[model samples]
Target chain A: MLERTKKSFLTALWILIITFPLMGLKTVFTGEQAEVGIRADAFYLAGVVFLCGMMWSMKGLIGRGIAFAVPPAKSCTGAIKTSVMKVPVWCWQVGILAMLCAFPFMGSEAELNKYFSFLIETLIYVSLALGLNIMVGMVGLLVLGYAAFFGIGAYTYAILSLNFHVPFWPSLFIGGAIAGVIGILLGIPSIRLRGDYLAIVTLGFGEIVRFVLKNEAAVTGGEQGLPNQHIPGAIAAPSLGFMVLDREIHYYYIAIVIMVLVVFVVHRLNNSRTGRAWIAIREDETAAMSMGINTFRMKILAFAISAFIAGFVGVFYAARMNFVNPEAFRFEYSVLILSMVILGGMGSVPGVILGAVILQVIPWLMRDMMPNLLREYFPSAANVAGTLTDFRLLIFGGIMVIMMIFRPQGIIGNARRKIELGVEEERD
Target chain B: MFQHIVDGTTQGAIYALIALGYTLVYGILGMINFAHGEVYMIGAYIGIISLAVFTATGMTLISLPLCVFVAFLAALFFCAAYGYTIEKTAYRPLRQAHILAPLISAIGMSTFLQNYVMLAHGKDKFDFPGIFRAAFINNTVQISGARVNYLEIFIIAASLVTMLCLHLMIRYTRIGKAMRATAQDKKMAGLVGININRVIPFTFIVGSALAAIAGVMVSMYVGATKFDDGYMAGMKAFTAAVLGGIGNITGTMLGGFILGLAESMGIWLISSDYKDAYSFILLLIVLIVRPRGLLGEQVSDRA
Candidate 1:
């Protein structure tokens, strides 16, 4: 306990020093004259850091997580989770389908549209994260520029549907096709380069794509995004559902259909011959080649399939939003999706979906819903939470770093992937 | 043409300085310091903040060069401190984890630093004060019938001098020799009684100091900077590092010059709006044609 206190104190002090330049120093200007003064938040930040340093998450949770490679995988909530998992798979699926079907009716009529949009957005990310899982988890190739393909998909729909007068249905598949072809083209160049080098290339590619979208003012509509991005006759589609549905409700169901389709396809692909080939390549490229597994083709197939899902989803995203902008597809978005895959349980479908939902819905709740709910009961806590919501990115960054150090296997890591990582547990 | 050359060389010098950080860390750790760009960014913020603080203190009236010198020192100290603290907290723990882990953490670190700066420093771009205006120095110099900014010349000359000092330090100093040994083989270097822990932190400090230098120079050159400015500059510098052979020092400098030249020339030939794409295109061509980079490579291929 004394040691923990000492460490936390030092960490807090160190944070104060590192943050002095930006946090402690404030240049306030009165007309033409300026003064350098210290702000009051330094103490607040120090207190938070000190408190967090001694918290169980810093030791017990992170320590247990790191040591998870050793079986048992015991935690406070682990038993409940295992019990839930023990229930038959089809039973869980039916339960989830019923819940999803009932989701639209769960809220007030006025707020139903907002919930639908939120769930739709979450579903879109679920599809995107699954695609990333194929590359990062299954193939063991980190594509840092996944957002570029997503942008290409969105743009393909916007341009095809808007300028060429293509309808929503063809534009959707064509978007995926174009992105998939480009994914193949991108894969060939970086095929020989492994690990970090591949990451940089993909990162560069993502930026290059974004720059092209921004620079090509005529077609992409530049910084303002594509003009009239709404999918023509999207509301009028599947006429049966359209009759009973509000427009937002229709988009919500469409998003669910896409997500379900993605989950199904990905699940099938996971058990197929090609899936085995990918797992082999990921395990050992040379060994896979020795086994006549054709590592190159399998790797390319992963890229093509991953990009296709992103493109297909991008069309849906554009259709739902009714506007597509270059800003919507940035490197941060790629990283966000990557984090979802990593956080959920990289190679696991249910885990990725759960991860996507947790990351997306929690942030939204923190920002919009929870604070308002808390305002009625604990006003002080609500203020702290509101302030925290403002620093969401900082907390995200901190959690990511802390999580990687403590639990590289993810919260619900795949059994196979855990072996692949084979991280040595650290002792304090 | 002359102007572009001058501009390219000036920008290239800065790239070389930042790329050295990437190359140096990649050399020692075998993982790209994704937050190296964030370090450069923080350096810029610190450099500008220190400049603002110094200007408010009445130090500029006493001796202008001393003011600039003091600002540089402040930036160096804080940047090195940041590099040391970040590595100790974030990267050190993941040394045994998967390769992808460190990269993700770095991305998170990058995001955190950007937002931290945005929150504390405010989102608006800070204008770098005109240092030359205080002194009676001519802001421009005539070179081969072309008027070049004195700041550009200063940036180039300053970086070259710093690089020379770095080369000397690496060749002569005991710690430098240890770093070289560590880079070659960590286990062997450890066996030879070198303190690998000290060497790793030292590498980060030296690299961050170089980035600090570049950050100060670029802020002066650009006249203004924002919280997110480091992302693009960092990417370009990382490309420059890879182009020169990611783990090589001299090659990184050469790569920086070539990349800068490509960007300027590409801008002159194509539209200026697509200048950011030029570095990426150059990277692609290099990766395809000569993956080892222009300098061949120092680190063994991981695969």
Candidate 2:
């Protein structure tokens, strides 16, 4: 108990140290303005509180204070196993704390808020990448229409929350449940198919969803989209003495919490029986079947679970953005998310997070930063050459090519996954 | 509805040409060559550049035939080089990897190519010079109140000639047979001393050339081309290829015509804004009922 308490204390201390600069800087920078400044100050305080809670919980791991509290292992394997199990939990606490602290800093500028939105968007992709990692990465299912689930989630939330005025949290769960059903329906066809055939079939299913959403204008709001819905408040009480609930900073934390939850759940699933079964099926479906695994059921489970997670994220996205359009849930989004999973280490959790963050945040950052720098440095050239948004696709495309050529395993790839996924073979 | 048929056929011919490239590449490499559409898009930009340069040189009405020929060659060379580079850089490394690697790389390359073009030429459409813009014969040969353009006849003839050439190339040539052999069994052909490397590049050259011709034809017909045209057009052509049979050349041609006809009729029946929805709906139904496509052979899992 003493050791655990000490460890928790250190984790709390580390979070405080890491997040202090951002909190301090925000208060200093935004001191002049009254309304926005006060709002920013409140956001920073909330961030500090959340960070403190996170750090307190993580102190044992960060400070090695729980070393004695850990049950003495008889073998090296046991010790290593325990350490491995503890590492991810520690990482999650650290990540959540970092995100909370970063939220206030992100809201310092209007432009930075867009990047923060993108960061939240990245969290959504991380959710997707984790979910897809189960299907394509673990189960070896080549799903070309993963966006169908995303659309289902988005449409479900939009219809329920917008039309019926249902609360965000309930609508979010319903959306996930609806998407889960759809995923199961789609997975039935997978029983008879494999590889490219399965891919094409999923592609068809995805297109069907897209077309239906496009044509069913009454239910979906069609091309015009469902818009202007206010973001749901976190607390029911109106007299909480804090009004950061509707702010972008508050939404950022909501996304961060959702992302952390998703990561935690997926991480647990990865180490569970289902994740192992998925790996078995991925390695060899025939072998998995020979081992008495119901391969069909597993594939369907993988699809359903992945879709469920995607739908969960989709709800948050709709609420945060307060908009849902068919165009937003295009085939390209599916492909892009898929690319994030593959380009990152396929089965590696941290790799998926890194991929999601880089792909989502980097482009937006570049979009915001590059054009202004170009304009400021070369005013005359900027007039004639145009901004980065005009040429953003080219630069983004170049980055992809470079990544594919140089590091197919992605920025934070796993070595074992690299070999298993055949990334090494491709490198050769 | 003669005009609809004419317009549909013209678009169908363009799709057919691009689909041939997709089919041929798929047949040889067993890969979708998703970047093929971008190659077609690039060809249109090349044609635009060629027109701009030629027009600036005081060439008033450079015969449509000569202009098209030049555009075709320029597009062919540029796109062929791109195809060769893509194969060498993106695909060559992932040759032994899971099929997903190459597919993802192709997507990356697709985005890269589109973005590259968008940057080089602004995001908006570039007008094709008026050399082939005018209708040859504006007479109404009405089937049911729709007027037909005689210029569409030229598009059909061009498409036929390109198809016939491709047919002959695959049927008669030694390299063509080598491509077929390589597609059938890469290792066996390599052991038999067929240079798979040479044959693959040659396939890309032929495929990209056809796509270039299609791009020029599309520009001539549409009167303008955009940097992002490849994505929509590519998706349509891919749909056409899949609708017929992915690796079957002749099936792709039939698929293109069917898709074009279906799209035109569907648009006429419904709203034009939902034309994409119509094609995708048809594609979905076809995939669900006939996953192997109308003429595609069953693909065996090798990896």
Candidate 3:
């Protein structure tokens, strides 16, 4: 025990040895180029050292607490699965549909606008997460550049509509098709690579897409961005008695309808033979190939299908935003979408939706809704409220780390995925 | 043309230093330390702060080199602690989890650190003190119709010396042998009584320390450091690691130099506006054509 304590202290000593120069010197020495007014404060140095030591000492306790609190993922997910199974599928579906349809009528303009906008954004991310789910969850390909497809879809639609005057409805399919083609192009090379290599390739491809979009100024309008995108209104002539889908509520319904359709299709696909092939590939590629799954074709198919959905969302995204920029599609966005899939429970339809909603809505509530509510009581809250928006990523990263450590299977984790995650497979 | 080479060499040296962190961590753990870049960023911040402290104390009045040495040491120490802490908090928990878990955790660490620093420091670039203000570094020499700054010479020499020391340590040191053994086979190494836990974090410490040195070098060279500086530079170094076949130290060095020269020469040959795209493009091509990279031996089929 004494030896172990010595070792632990030595570790702390090592940390202090490194940290002393970085923090202590900063507080004491100030900086080489600092002006005369600046002076090193002893208090700050003491505080930094104390903090470091505290963190170092508490490390073991924290690790143990986290480890102890985190129950095996299998049990947690099994509980979720059983509870979900108790509810009739059709009843839940109808209930969701009713709630969505009545959402706009629930509140005033300010409230409705906020909820409607939040719902729309959440639904868009759902689609993105669902698309990523096919690759990461179903097929087990870690794509770090999934947002490139999202961008591709948006750009294809923007360029086609802006240049060729393509109609919004047709442009949506065309955009999706173009994205699918790009996916296939990417897939051909990626099929040979596995895991981290595939991730790097996709990441690189994403950067390439962004650079091309940014550099090809004539087509993408460069940094100024392509603006004034055509929004889809009235499925037909307004005189035919159909409502023109120009309002936020109309957009909300349209987005929800699309989301429901995507969920349904993804659910059906999950049960299909192709989905089984994907599962096989995910489980063990070599085994799946030997079993004659045509792993390459399925992988490409997954990529294409995933890209198609992203493209579909991209059209609606462009329409809703009424503008498109290369900046909108970045590598970080891909990570965000990927997080939704992973956090929700990879390879599970309901899991992805839950993940998307939770991740998106939490940030929305923290950054926008919470501040709005808080500022109503405390007028001075406005200044601090704005900074909450800046902390969004910090919170996001913290959640991801905590989630991975505590609940790797996610809130609504798939059983197979739990197994893949190395959670002890509980015999139910 | 020669000036581009000189510039490329300095940039490449820094990239090599950063790449060593990536390669060392990857070699030991079989996981890409995505947050390694953020660790470098923290080092840069520390470098700036330490310089301010030194200047405040009038330490330059004593000896400029001594002052700079203290600042570099400070940055190195803090970054090493950050690196070790990150491993303990974000990585250790997910060591036995699926591959994606650690990667996600790393991404989270990266995002968290970036935002945390942004919040603490405010979202503005800080000016870095130029440590090497001596007559040698202040002057430039004409080489093949191009001006080569003495600072560039210093950067190259510093990078080479660091790499040499690291190579010697890894080859001759007891801890280095243990690290190598654990990297080769963790279970087997443990069976042979090697302390896996200590070895892993130690690897992180050394790798992070190297990154700190690189970070300080970079800030000094550029005369400024920003919150997001780590992301692009990290990506470039990551590219260099992959280009040289990740986990191979010598290959990482070669990859860094090659990437640096390629970017410099490519900009000269073509356009500078898309300079950032060069590394990504090279990474894609390499992964597609030769996943093993220039000097990477066969990575086990598992990863």
True contacts kept of each: 0.60, 0.34, 0.65
Worst ten-residue run, lDDT, model 2 chain A? Answer: A28-37
A-chain TM-score per prediction?
0.86, 0.71, 0.79
Interface Cα RMSD of candidate 3: 4.4
**Residues B1-303, candidate 2, lDDT per residue (tens digit)?**
666776778788888889888888777777778799998987777665565544544453656557556766776666676667667767777666656667878888898877766654557787776644554544335556776666577778989998998888888999878988887778889999999889888888788888888887788778788978998888788888888988888889988988888888887777786777666677767766777777887765433
Ranking of all candidate structures by their DockQ, best first: 1, 3, 2
What's the lDDT for residue A208 in model 3?
90
lDDT of 1 by residue, A200-249 (tens): 78988999999989988898889988773444553223234336333888
The alpha-carbon deviation from the true structure for residue A388 of candidate 1, after best TM-score superposition, in angstroms, is 3.1
**Cα shift from native, residue A179, model 1 (Å):** 1.0
Quote fnat for model 2: 0.34
Query: For each candidate, what TM-score against the reference?
Result: 0.92, 0.80, 0.89
Best by lDDT: 1
Sliding window of 10 residues with minimal summed lDDT for model 1 chain A: A233-242
Per-residue lDDT for B54-172 in model 1, tens only? 76887767877777788889899999999998888788887777666777778778888888888887789877776633242356878888787667778889999999999889889
TM-score of 3: 0.89
Q: Is the docking of candidate 3 incorrect, acceptable, medium or high quality?
A: medium
lDDT of each: 0.82, 0.73, 0.81
